[model samples]
Target chain A: MAPDQIVFWVFAPVSVGSAVAMLFQRNAIHAALFLIVNFFTLAVFYLVLGAPFLFAVQIIVYAGAIMVLFLFVIMLLGVDREESLVERLRGQRPLAIVLGLGLAAEIFVTARASLGLARGPANFDETVNVGGNAQALSHVLFRDYFLPFEVTSILLIVAAIAAMVLAQRRERTTVEAAGEAEV
Target chain B: MKTPISYFVVLSAVLFAIGSVGVLVRKNALVIFMSVELQLNAVNLALVAFSRLHGNLNGQVLAFFSMVVAAAEVVVGLAIIVNVYRRMHTANVDDASLLRW
Candidate 1:
C-alpha cells in the first residue's frame, strides 16, 4: 500500500468513529467536541484528495468558525445534560426493531449489487489541466458562476439578518422588565 | 498501489448512513445537528473523490460551496436552537410532538 493509502485508511476511521461517538454522546458539549475531531479528520481527507483549497476551508471555516459557533451556543444555553438524557421511547422497541431490520436488509441488497463490480482506478496524477488552486477558483467564481456567487452572498446576508432578528426577539422578551424599570 | 477511490466512496457512504441514522434515531437536538454536519462532510468526501476521478475542479468547487452553506446553516440552526430552548425550556425533539404523528 502507498503512503497515501495508509493516510486515508487511518483518517477515514478516525472521522467515522468520532461521528458515531458524536451521535451517541449524551452531553451536548461532548458531542460537539467529537464533531470537531470529525471535521479535522475530514480536512485531512480533503488534503489527501488534492483539494488544498478545500482542505484550508474545511479547517478554517468548518472546524474553526462553525464549530466555535456551536460551542458558543452550547456555552450560552447551558444545556442540562440530565434532563436531555430522558428517553422518550418507552414503548417503541418494536418500531425500532422493525426500522433496524429494514435498514439491514437494504444494506445487504446494496452490498450484493456492489459486489464484483470493478473498482475504478484512482487518479494520482497531479499534473492534470484542471487547476484546483485558489486562482482557478477565483476565476470561476467571478466569471462563469458570477451570478450564483452574488446570489450566495445575498443569501448569506439574509441569513445573518434572520439570525439577528431571532436573537433580538429573545433578547427583547428576556430584558423587557429591566428595560421598563430603566425607562 | 494506493487505496482505491471506491474505498473512499464506500467510507463516505457509511459515514453518511450513520449520520442519517443519528438524525433519525437521536432525540437530542444537538446530536442531530452534528449528524447533519457529518452527512455534509460525507458529501464533501464524495465530491473530492469525483474530482480526483474526472480530473476536473468542479467537485472541489461544489465542496467549497457546501462548506460555506454548512457554515451558514450552523449559524442559522444554532440561533433557532437558542430560540427554541428559550421558548420551550427544552430541546427534546421527540417531545416536540405538538405537531403530532
Candidate 2:
C-alpha cells in the first residue's frame, strides 16, 4: 500500500471513532474535545488531498474558531453535568438506530457497486502546481466567486445582529421581571 | 500507487450517518448542534475529495463557502442556545417546548 493509503487508514479510524465517542459523551466539554480530535484528523485528510489552503482553513475555522465557540458556550452554560438519558420522544432512539444502520448499509452497497468502475486517482499535482493552493484558491474565489463572497459577508452581519437582538431581549425581560418583583 | 476516490466518499457517508444519529438520539441542544456541524464537515470532506478527483478548484471554492455559512450558523445557534438556557435554566431541547399545546 502507498503512504497516502497508510495515512488514510490511520487517521480515518481516529476521526470516525472520536466522532462516535463524541456522540456518546455525556459531558458537553468532553464531547467538544472529541470533536476537536475529529476536526484535526479531517485537516490531515485535507492535506493528503493536496488542498493546503483548505487544510489551513479547516484547522483555523472549524478547529480553532468553531470549537472555541462550542467550548465557550459549554463552559458558560455550566451544563457540564451528566446528561440524562431519558427519552425525550418515545421510540426516537430505536428509530434513529434503525435509520442510521439503513443509511450505512445503503452507502456501503453503493460503494461496493461502484468500486469495480472507479478510476485510479487522477493527477492532482498539476492542479496544486498552478501557482500554489492558496494563490489558485484566491484567484478563483475573488475573480469568479466575488458575488457569493460578498453575500456571505452580509449574511454574517445579519446573523450577528440577530443573535445580539435575541440575547438582549432575553436579558431585558429578566431585568424587568426582577424590578417588578422589587416594586 | 493512487488511492481510489470511493474510499473517501464512503468515509464521508459513514460520518454523515453518525452525525444524523447523533442529532436524533442526543437531547442536549449543544450536542445536537455539534452533530449538525459534524454533518456539514462530512459534506466538506466529500467536496474536497471530488475536487481532487476532478483535478479542478470548483469544489474547493464551494467548500469554502460552506465553511463561511457554518461559521455564521454557529454564531446564531449558540446565541439561541444561550438565550434558551437563560430562560428555562436548562439546555434540553424538550424542556423548551413552550409552543406544544
Candidate 3:
C-alpha cells in the first residue's frame, strides 16, 4: 500500500471510534471532546481527498470555532447533569437495530458502486497542486458561484440576529418572585 | 496507489450512521445538536470525496457552503437550547418537549 492509503487506514478507525465514543458518553463535555477527535480525523480525510482548502477550513472552523462554541455552551449550562445512554422513548432500541441493519446494507452498496467509479489517484491533483487548491476554488467560488458566496453572508446575518433574539434571558428574580407570590 | 473513493464514501456512511445513532439515543439537547453537526460533517466528507472523483471543485465549494450553514445553524440551535434550558430548568428533551403557551 502507498503511504497515502496507509494514512487513510490509520485514521479511518480513529474517526469511527471517536464517533462511537461520542455516542455513548454520558457527560456532555466528554461527548464534545470525543467529537473534537472525530472532527480532526475528518480534517485528515479531507487532506487525503486532495482538498487542502477544505482541510484548513475543517481545522479552523469546525474544530476551532465550532468545538469552542459547543464547549462554551456546555460550560455555561453546567455539566453536573450527566445524562444516561438508555433510551427513554418506546421504540428507540428497535429503531437502532433497524438503523444498524440499514447502515450495513448502505455501506455494502456504496462500496461496490463507488469502487468501480473512482479508481486510483484523483484528477483534481493536477490543478490542485499547480494552481493551489484554495486559489482554484476561489476562482470558481467568485466567478461561477457568486450567488452562493453572497448568500453565505445573508444566512450568517440572519442567524446572528436570531441568536441574539433567542439569547435574551428574562430576569430570574421576577420569575422567582412570582413563584413565591403564587405560593 | 491512493485510497479508492469507495473507502472515503464508506467512511462517510459509517460516520453519518454513528451521528444518527447519537441523535436518536441521546436525550440531551446539546448532545443531539452535536450529533446533527456530526451528520453534517459526514456529508461534507462525502461531497469532497466525489469532488475529487469528478476532478471538479464544485463538491468542495458545496462543502464550504455546508460548513458556513452549519456554523450559522449551530449558533441559532445553541441559542434555542439555551432558551429551552432557561424556560424548563433542564436541557433534557423529555422534560423540555412541551410547546404550550
Better of 1 and 2 by TM-score: 2
Q: With candidate 2 superimposed using the best TM-score fit, by how many Å does residue B41's alpha carbon deviate from the native?
A: 0.3
| RMSD to native, candidate 3 | 3.2
> Model 1 has how many clashing residue pairs?
0
TM-score of each: 0.83, 0.92, 0.91
Candidate 1 residue lDDT tens string, B1-101? 25566666777777777777777777777778888998899889988877776666677778877777887788788888888888887877876677786
Estimate, for each residue in A47-137, the C-alpha lDDT of model 3 and write its tens digit. 8888888999999999999999999998998955887646666798679857965985688696876476465444557855458888888
Instruction: State each candidate's chain A TM-score.
Output: 0.74, 0.86, 0.84
Instruction: Give the lowest summed-lDDT range of ten residues in model 3 chain A.
Output: A114-123
lDDT of 1 at A134: 73
Of 1 and 3, the candidate ranking higher by TM-score:
3
Point to the candidate with the largest lDDT: 2
For candidate 2, what is the DockQ-based docking class? medium
**B20-96, model 2: which lDDT tens digit per residue?**
99999998999999999999999999898878777778899999999999999999999999988988999999888
List interface RMSDs for the candidates, in order: 3.2, 1.7, 1.7
Error of 1 at B83 (Å): 0.8
DockQ ranking of the models: 2, 3, 1
DockQ of each: 0.49, 0.70, 0.68
lDDT of 2 by residue, A37-92 (tens): 99999899888887888899999999999999999998899997787888867898
Question: Which runs of model 2 end up more than 4 angstroms from their true locations?
Answer: A114-121, A169-183
